[model samples]
Target: METKKYPIIVEQFHFDMVDPKTDTNQNVQVAMRQVEPSDPARKDELKSGNMFEIMVPFDVIPPQAGFRVSGKITRVVQTLDYFGQANEISPDDLEKLSRPLIEYIETLTYQVTAVALDKGYQLEFEASGNQKDNQ
Candidate 1:
């Protein structure tokens, strides 16, 4: 059988919350955007309509959230494809893509923790929240 493999990119990864432990009392959203592909030698690479969004309930946030937020986007490529068509993704493909997305989520979690820790010693602050933007 003939075969063609296209790239699959994660356009957007949205999460309702990052902290499952405390999400019951709050709301959260995480969004990721994918840009059009580029070629080093080409001055003008296509740049439009290559974005998507995903949303999940706050409760779904993992107990340990970090650079690798479970269910967050993996990677954004050209078209979501594996050994066959885009519609039929293999388990291996899924696993391969998941690693990076998970890493990104884990990283975000650490950033939030660091900020929270930094302010813990302050005496005048009654309450403080940390907003993290991770890679």
Candidate 2:
């Protein structure tokens, strides 16, 4: 089988799903999100909740890192300055756009900034982190 490996994969789960006879002791898996090397990192401004913005490569079943969130860009927000120059969304707006999907996205980025939103709300990416361990 040709299996591909990723730096991280995140899965959502439901602890409330109980099958009367099939299963009751397990939390049902609900949703899953995956990120390839194209994934972005957590922003420096948002790194206060992280350890030096080094998001790890791992998976979360229930998405625990979402108590507040790590950092990942789901939406790109653009703003304008007084000079008509383009500007990044204020921290307030960044948080506003990121808060809801933090669980799903941060899980993919692993709170690292290798891939993240930039000053223009565009995705800032580092080189692809995919590596071939089998080789």
* Stretches > 4 Å off in candidate 1: 1-74, 79-83, 118-135
Candidate 2 TM-score versus the reference:
0.20
Give the lowest summed-lDDT range of ten residues in model 1.
119-128
Q: In candidate 1, what are the lDDT values of residues 1-135, reduced to their tens digit?
A: 122223334444443433435432222333333444466553233231222222222212333332122233334433222223333444454334333444444444455545643421111101122233322
TM-score to native of every candidate shown? 0.35, 0.20
lDDT score, candidate 1: 0.33
Consecutive 10-residue window with the lowest summed lDDT within model 2? 23-32
TM-score, candidate number 1: 0.35
List the global CA lDDT of all models: 0.33, 0.26
| lDDT by residue (tens digit), candidate 2, 35-124 | 222235634322222111112222222221112122222322222221121122244533333343444443333323223322111112
lDDT, model 1, position 64 = 36
lDDT for model 2? 0.26
Please report the candidate that would top TM-score against the real structure: 1
Candidate 2 stretches with Cα past 4 Å from truth are 1-58, 63-73, 82-90, 103-135
